[model samples]
Target: MSGREFDLVLYGATGFTGLRTCQYLARNYKQGVRWAIAGRSASKLEEVREKLVNIDPGLSTLSIIQADASSPESLEAMAARTKVVISTVGPFLKHGEPLVAACVKQGTHYVDSTGETPFVLDIIRKYHKEARDKNIILVPECGFDSVPSELGTKMVVDFLRKEYNLPTKSVKLSVTKLRGAVSGGTLASICEVMEGKEGGMKDTLDQNQLVPEDVASKVVPARITLPSVFYDHDFKAWQAFFIMSFANEKIVKRSHGLAVEADGVGYGPEFTYRESMSAPGFFTAALASLGMGLGGAALSVGPLRRFIQNRILPAPGTGPSDESITQGHFTVKIIGESSLPENVPADASADALKPIKAIATIQGGEPGYSETCRYLVEGALCLVQNEDRVRNENKITGGVLTPAYAFGHILIDRLRAQNVNLTVSKL
Candidate 1:
């Protein structure tokens, strides 16, 4: 804790994901990282540090910060010296509140690998005001759940505006393919969230963040059916809601509402975004959707819940190796449609209103934990590189944002440079 505090302090560094992040930092930390690992155990912190040294001898300079989530004081101390804190600890309802409170109180910028919608809603309601008051940014879901979806939306919408000259009406996101080993942390997150939380979590939902007390009170997640015009048309398949739809769409809407040119490619003015899973046919899509819907509905029963618990992801903390991650990749084929709004444009032909085909695909590292870690690590880099980000003495905050708004180009470049080549190409 000398001059320049540290660039980033990785909390929960002993966890599976946190260890991976430290591994990433160690490999790429060619210059002054001014970094340290923080967790409950000094012993585990030292052990992780040794592993880092083994992977990259240049990481010998890495340091440690022993902090307990149970103690607000330790958390505050750890936050005090870091410009940013990337936390991979979760099931947040159980182990997250104290550290979050410390970050808000310390005015340190915070990011987390959490997809727990209820937990995010809780934090937003409870701390958004305090964070705003302190002029800090508490960004959540900088992980696999929403990063691709959010950034993917930005890329597609921007392309439509640039190449097709049309405002977007709606954007759909889905997991095209995901196959990887699971970890205990992932399993724990699934169980805590699937089982639902005590309504006490809602105590943190911020009324003034988006709506007034009166308006926010009645606000609900309004649902809409798929466009009849979309099915059996341009799309080669059917899709359904992503489990983490709440976080991704909400943040996209927030960013769209704040941006001046949100109209051009449907940031918010004429368009909205939804999430889903890609399926080969409508029948398969409906079945998968039903299965997910039923899972949510049935988690409350003891027998069903217990049955799931028995099927823990092939052993917790088990993840793909370096060889696999280096080989894995993803591509998002965005089918962009450009059309003239119907207002009786006399000269407009049906083809003129028809969707002119355009596509964008993002190339990135292999999916699952390693790729998720890569995205997470790159997301932190994006945050650091954002022009919109305003840094002060011991603090850096940004205006309203999603990862794309804050760090899209940086992440793309970094990911590409890291060998996860991405491209915008013809379909």
Candidate 2:
């Protein structure tokens, strides 16, 4: 048993997605779960608690505490009291490090829904070693941003390794169907990237900065251009640039790297990955690609970027209507290609050397908020419930980690229990 007073603490609980997360905990969290709601204002935290009580009247007695990003001491106190922390605070580049620092220092496990590549890379560079020493698991991208891609690919790689006894050589993921809008927090984080910080995505995207030197040296990534659209015969869909690819691809790479360095079970030494969304036809793909390119260009300009951030997008605390949340869903398909063993005879039949493929489908609801809440809350639960398994069975002691690196198949099992559809089959 953890020495902490609480099993979980939901920080930033007054924000749009944060409040939803509290409700999720109230409805689905097991009875006697010791949890609290926290944010900058005591009144706002109380308001959120009241709303949660409406969902589960028993929660009227649930705890509420004050902890602000600007108050490191408060964050420290909050961290010290919880076994695990689930943070929904974002533009994490701007408002996240304090809580992360406190968690690491306090020896608390931490998870967040951050897609800020620069922030994640910084965490890796600065805190991974220390967290490892302290037996702390610091996992980011515990939401829609990259969970499906990171863990979906892991599902494929795991299947291939088990079925054919071979490593995965290359993989492509296509968003086949999506019906969701971005959250205000996610948009804010994207705008923060466009506001142009030094050593931001540019540096993260420069040379696969997410992977360590030793692992990166063994793998060669396929060349991919984000502004281009094309046809993918294998998936039988027109493919277009995916804005989130920069982060998702790098995260999947980090998972593979950890497999080699920590577990010695990898997709292969030369594994490569790319991501795109499937379009109806070539025309739709071309138009979508052009729009994304133009949007990127517009966001890079100071005046346009400010106008979009200030006037057009939702505020950090706001979000789409509840009806929209109910109507939202997403599906992604990952195709994994097999790598031939080195000792295969040169005279082997063409059928023997032909690229074998497996497909993994990951589907869920209301990606930006609802499904994201499930992923985040379930991920936190995985840490709380399976920390010993991750440490002892998986031998994944600690580090700045992707969901797959931190929890392995344990997370997949948790999601399956939550009714998430994760299916894999040979193609």
Candidate 3:
């Protein structure tokens, strides 16, 4: 890794998020941090480099590597040249596996902004053992799909343990404030998942399907069921089905599972995580819930999905207006409830033993694009700058990992420094 040609390589640099990530790197580029921009088109990569050079003239000399997701040899070459790779290419189900395989073959650490859970489960099942054996990590969903959800949950779990010395029993996350637009890449990925092209939506429904068998074995199956639309007393807001919850909840569960495997204890034996989008009133919540359900139903059908993809949604590589990207924002509120400690008196009244509670919030700008670029770039830097520390501190040998398990507090600190606020307190 020390002798690698570059410290990091931004693959798919021409894509919407990839271009944003390149700009982010240019604006925040540190001295002596060797990095390169790569994609299938040398011309597109050069164009991106030119834009970056405008931000910093020094980037005029920035290297460009021509690599395509379809070309395994090119991907391997790119992977071999860089110690770490950040991929923004999607819908990953169609074009992601080759690059991941190449990265693992080249022993390069990898990160991506993929939200497709079936693809993630596929990678974990196929490459986790080999990646672990090679001592290289591959972390997907480093972007808005689940980074905030996973990391926010970790913050609450840590608070419960440090403040009250109690294990977390349940954690609920609500997207209380979200003002953002969809990206073409994101929409494409959603279409693919809805079409059942990559292992189907069923793969994402069960928590056990997303994690390794050993880790899943220790998890206590959840018993409580939540409605699609409900009023949450904790947040005093009506809640609806959050589009990203299917992916986020599974990622959070995997993080907890990995923690349990690492230490024999995690959030807790009965820990369960659920997520929803908050609305101002019950009517809004109901409308949102119905809209999402209808949208999903439409996407699941062949003709309607094609119509939506071709006529309604933006094409791949395109996204929201710059103003939308600049003005968009989101806030997720996380609540963690503590379980009874083993030392509780046998005769203690149930009413007297109230579960301790903690709240954590993750705030950022433009969930689908701007803030996601920051999460993707910072996540890659965390791996680059704290490789040995993260591995040693977490007792992780490397594999397909969630953001919290892979970067933990290092990533949290990085995001905070970037003004992507993550805060926690006792309630």
Candidate 4:
């Protein structure tokens, strides 16, 4: 009998996102690293391995396991052999529940790339209790959808406590920079949900769970969501509508509920930040908003949703090229306000900017896939690597925790080492 078990198993390794995840694992794969490629197709897994072999001959040590998402027995079998299972198989509301159930029941740590907030909320509500008891980490949106943004927000809040004072009056995250196209898979998932093809994620909001349910919900969040037109005192930067409440808003809301120290800060002050890209002409911004308005509306109905998936994305596993993903750029510019006394001078107190602030960006081929693989895997790696002790310490886990709380300085240091753009920027 082979005594070795894989450290991580890449479930759904045959999808577009799955394939990219495998590529990332390959680049970071070490000789003794126990990892495997898994999905419904044996031939496709073999094909991916062959391509990997072309990239690096020594990767022959990589393993393969054929598992079908439809089969719970197969999922449970896959779960037992791995400490952590990072899955890219989504449209999750459609093809996910089985694997998640298996992981939780078997005491395996589970992570997935999902922005379907309602579906995740359902899983947590339905399974978080059991997983918590098992000490299993069931995290979703382990992708560009929110990890870095969530983790970055957590870092800024921690910085406030360590430097200026304990607990930030308020913290905010704005998309100062971001540019990318949605994939077919992304579009397809949206279409299904809009068309009612997606079931099992209806009560995410009332459940009060960001992605998980049954956790205490009275704490403050690390980041706040402001108005579309928040005031930036120093820079006087007036940000336009960056409609991210779709994913980020929910995560931030959950983070507030799961916080350990900043429980008093409340769900961050209302500040909606954005990177207004246009000709600076009123028409341009208006046009963009109109387009978004139309898209947003369509995202909820069957016809418009169907059109996007059919015309825009086209295939379930289709996405941008590796080169395109590698060449993308992302940015965020957030502005915050504090409880200033009457007559707070402008230039006189220019130095007194929101006790805490930060700008974080990750450059990669495809943020949704490539960079997400790096971020989520690193999150899992950080969690497993630094399970004991913390810069703050004495923090409790579970109940919709913040990424910073869950991962901490260990994660920040690791991300910086990976060359992610991180710094304290004003305005």
Kindly provide the TM-score of model 3 when superposed on the true structure, using C-alpha atoms.
0.96
- Candidate 2: lDDT over CA atoms? 0.85
Backbone clash total for model 4 is 15
On lDDT, the leading prediction is 3
Residue 398, model 2, lDDT: 84
Count of backbone clashes, every candidate in sequence: 9, 0, 0, 15
Q: Residue 116 CA error for candidate 3 (Å)? A: 0.3
lDDT of 4 by residue, 6-45 (tens): 7778898888888877787677755545778899999999
Query: What is the TM-score of each predicted model, taking all chains together?
Result: 0.81, 0.96, 0.96, 0.82
Q: How much lDDT does each candidate structure score?
A: 0.63, 0.85, 0.88, 0.62
User: 404, model 1: CA deviation in Å?
Assistant: 2.7
lDDT of 1 by residue, 1-427 (tens): 1344876789988988889888878777666556778999999888998999987887776778899978889999989887678888876767887888888777677777886766776776688667766766676777776677666676666676777666655666555664455567776777777667333324113212332232332333334432121242434667754455555666655445434332232243445456556677777777777776676556656567667767734344555676766666665544444444556477887766665445555545555566677777777655444424434221334322345555555666777778864555323
The RMSD (Cα, Å) of candidate 3 is: 1.9
- Give per-residue CA lDDT, model 2, range 64-163, as digits (tens): 8899999999999999999899999988999999999999999999999888888898888889899989988999998887899988798888888899
Stretches of candidate 1 off by over 4 Å are 1-3, 163-165, 197-221, 224-232, 240-247, 257-266, 281-287, 310-328, 336-345, 354-358, 385-401, 424-427
**Which run of 10 residues does model 3 get worst, by summed lDDT?**
197-206
